[model samples]
Each structure stands twice: as structure tokens, then as C-alpha cells.
Target: MKIMKTVQKVPGGMMVVPLLIGAIINTVAPHALKIGSFTTAVFSSAGVASFVGLQTFFVGTNLKFKEAPEALRRGSVLLVAKYLAGLILAIITNKIFGLSGFLGISVLAIICSVTGSNGSLYLSLMGTYGDSKDTAAQGILNIHDGPFLALITLGASGLASIPLLSLLAAIVPLLVGCILGNADKDLRDFFSPGASIVIPFVGFTIGAGINFSLIIKAGLSGILVGLLVFFVGGGLSILADRYINKRPGYAGAAIASAAGNTIASPAAIAIIDPKYKPFVASATTQIAAAVVLTVIIVPPLVAWMAKRYGCPKFDEQKAKNASLQES
Candidate 1:
């Protein structure tokens, strides 16, 4: 069995499946893994925190500083649009619900979920339906690797008084890795796979921290947030790509999906502000669900938008492939 191929066939399966499996095991037998030996070393919350930090470092190494200016411009436009969408949502939600949150959803979670783009999904879609410039934008878009943006937005809103040093602490690993990677091509290649390889471990660790019951309560709210990410992110990106970037806007739709790493942001935020701890479990679950929801929904929407906007090669190939399968 082509296990890797099979797994890759499912949208976000690499991260999502491990997460679900971990969540189920942890839910059913919370104490089974706590045998006080090697099991504790690998799956404990401390272990997860280590992996999350390591993952951030790996992601930083993958950023290419010497990319074409056009790629940076395109990516910046999308990033700004995505950030603004989530910032607007956070501000509105804060005004209405304040720090207490509403209907099991917190402003912190809302900001994190909407602001971060699913780079994996975006790359997949862009590879198929977009141009080189579109795909290259991942370099700049990846800066949203951690919870820094969410924290920054919250601080800006006066909802939280996060220390500047804490904000720098969150970004320092990525910055160090970026400097090392930029200085050495070999180092970049070596650390690049670490980003992908560490995801399942991180996902499993995050899943184990969550309770399935919280997932059930947050599922619908997460789905609603995912839909909002799709439309608002998609709409703004399309406009930016067309007007600002002067390119076909397929990338806009492609990048509108919520990122898998977003599942970690809620917990990361909780670390920054203990006040957010109450919402962390539900927010984590909700963000995980949103990642899945957007992964499934955004690709088709991108294809449709591509067709409507007059990109036929992608759809033509897709139709050809589908017909070939029928034969």
C-alpha cells in the first residue's frame, strides 16, 4: 500500500488524522500513557511544548529571503488582507462580548483562526491552479507561523497588556532560524523537512491536550468561523490579486483556507495570557475543526473562482482527469 500517497490524498490528512487518533486515545484512556517512564517523555504536555518550539524554528528556516520582489508583494497583499479580516473580527467580537467571549468562542481564537492561511493547502492549490508567483508567495505568508499576530492584535485593542519582551520571545526562534537559513543554503535544505515532519507530532501532542467533549461544543462555531474565513479571506485576496498585484486571482481563493498550525495558536495565546486559558481547549478544538472545514471547502471554491475569473487550464485538466477516471 502506498501509505504516504494514500494519506496525502486526504486534505490535511497528515496533521488531522494523527490529531484525531491522539484525541480519541487521550479521551478514552487519559491515564494509560502516564506510565511514568518513556511514554511520559514522548506524549506529555511538556514534550508537546518542546516540539512546538522546534517546529517554529524549522518553519523559520524554510523562509527564503532572496525571493523575487513580485512574490513578496503578492504575499504581503494577501497577508495584510488576512490580518485585517481577523483584526476586524476580533475588534467587533470584543466590543460585543469583551474578554468573556460569546457562545464558546473567544476573540483570541477568532483572530488566530482567520488570520493564518493554510500554507500547505495554499501551496497544493497554487501548484495546480496558480502561477509561479502565486506559489512563491508562501515565503512571505509563512510569517504567521505562531500566535504573535493574534497577541499583537489583542494588545492593540487594549484587551490585553502583553509585554513587548514576550512578543519578541515568541518570534526569536523563527528569526534566528531565518538568519541561519539565509546565511546557508545547506542549512535551509536540512531544516525544511523538519517543518513538515514535525507537524504530526505537534498535532498529536495538541490533540492529546484537548477533550473531545469540548470539540463537540465548539464544532459548529468553528465551522461558522471557517465559512467566514473562506468568504472574507477569499473576497479580499481576489480583489488584491486583481487590483494590487495585477495577476489572476486564483491565489486569493487558494490561500483563503485556515492553516493547520492555527490549532496551536489558542494554547500559545493562553501561555501569553492566563486569562485565555479557559477558552484554550475549546478554541484549539474549534481551530482544528476549522482547518479541516476550510481544507475541504476552499479548494473547490478556488477552482470555481478560477473558472469564473477565466482561468481554464486548471479546470480543463481537472475535467480531463475526471473523464479519464470514468473510462
Candidate 2:
């Protein structure tokens, strides 16, 4: 009962707390632990492992492989929209600004890929717009952005060189969790507590990337890029929510896109571009900024959009009706 009560109170508590702890450690003691690159890699690996374990424990309980096709289909559609949006924007910025080389292009791509944990938060906040299936799908889809960002930033040449084995090492556990969740409800319940633990780690790791120097270097150009990606990506997502989802009051979904998942981007970049360690600081700062912006801005915008568009309240009545019809 205590565990249940805590879980109820803090939905993503597990993920959020450790992340703050990490940030505090970074801020207070970055130099305290001078582990070599190998140790750093070990820490990173450990973090990923924790995340995968948490995901597996929760998702396994919720697994329903029979539903995999539908989930995959939805995930694929979202992936395409996400990648296409980022790629086009990056290309335009590169062409117009006369920016050359992978560095500039990669930075722009990273910005686009930084959509945060809004989908999970939206699932918690909106309460009615999404069902279990929608929530599950969002969880799975959220994991993809990191890998996709890595691929895009690396480009064709680096893409081939990227350590696929390492990438899969990070991704497979989460996938396994989701698959398990589809299969067993009890397992999902067991792992659910870990979600709160792992979720904030995502935030913290992303936050650790933030340093003052990189922000100064990025200056006005980086700020502009971040804003453009946030707004345009947001707008396109809104359109998709309306036309594709065909569900009323879908502004929450739009906000999810705008919320840019910054935490994963830095790690992705680190893995892809060893020479660009400093850029990780820039990515981190940008992600922190994006997180603040998304949390503050996206929710209100979604509410306003819903009201303006005459979106009906997603209440129990609607749910009951849908459930009955489906049954």
C-alpha cells in the first residue's frame, strides 16, 4: 500500500529523482570523480542498464505481442514524421546559412531531435486523451528518437562507422521490456516503480551536458535553431494530431513533439562523435533550455488550442461509449 501510494503520487518519480541527484553531483562534484574514459563509459553503460531494467520490469507486465503490429505501425508513422521534420529543417539551415561540414549539420539535427518527455507527462496529465495502448505506444516511440538522432547527426559516412553493436546494446533491453509489458500485467506493475527512478536519470544525464562555454559559443545561432525547431516541429505535430489522429483535443500530442527529448541526444552525440566532446556541453545546455521551455510553454498552448478548436472534454462518458462500441 505504501509503495502503491508513492507510485500514485509520483508517476515518473523513479526517473526524475535520480536525474536530479546526478545534476547535483555534476554541479557540485564533477571533478570529484576523475575516472578515465573507460570508467565514464562504464557509468554510462550502468545508467543505460538501469534504464533497460526498469523498462523491462514495467513493460514486460504490459506486453501483448499480438498487438505488436499495431504498435509498430503507429511507432513507424511517428518516426517518419519526426525524422523528416528534423532532416528538412537541418538541410534548410545548412543551405541558407552556408554552414559546412558535419558539425553544423549535426548540431541542428540534435536540436530537432531533443523532444522531451512530454508524451509521458501528457499521458499522466491529460488523463483521458490516451488509453493504455496509446501510452504504451508513446513509451516505445519515445525511445526511438535517441537512435534516430544519432543516425542523422552522423550522416551517411559516420552512420556506417557508428558502433551499431553499442547502439543495439542500449536499445534492446527497453524493447525487451516493452515486449514483456505486452505479455504480463503483473510484470508491468513490478517494473512500474522503476519508471520513476529511471525517468529522472534521463533528465539528469541530459542536464549534465549543459555547460556555460558551449552556450556562449552557440550564441544567437543556436538559440534561433532551437526556437525554429520547437515552433515548426510543434506546428507540424499539431496538424498531424488533427488530421491523422482524428481525435479531438489532441493538442497534448502536439505538445509532446515540441517537448524535445534532450536527455538522450547528448548520449547519442557522444557515442557518434568522439571528437565533439565540447559539443555535448552545448547539446546539454540547449536541452535544459528546451526542457524548461517545453514544460512551461507546451501545456498551456495545448490547453488553449483545445479550447479554440472546440475539442470536447475527454471524460468518462466518452470513454464508456468508445469501450462499449468496441466491445
- Give per-residue CA lDDT, model 1, range 209-327, as digits (tens): 54556435566887777777787766777788778877678787777777777788888778767888888877777787776667656766776677677453556778899999999
lDDT of each: 0.70, 0.48
After superposition, candidate 1 runs with Cα above 4 Å error: 1-67, 156-217, 312-327
Error of 2 at 126 (Å): 11
Backbone clash count, each prediction separately: 0, 32
Model 1 residue 152 CA deviation in Å: 1.4
TM-score of each: 0.60, 0.55
lDDT of 2 by residue, 1-327 (tens): 585456434323333334345545555667532365744533332344344344434543454666656655554455455555666665665666533324443453344443334444343333323333444455445544344554554462355354466545544654687766656677767766554344444444433433334334566545544455457666655566567655453543444433445545666555666655555665555554555344434545555565466443445557779999999
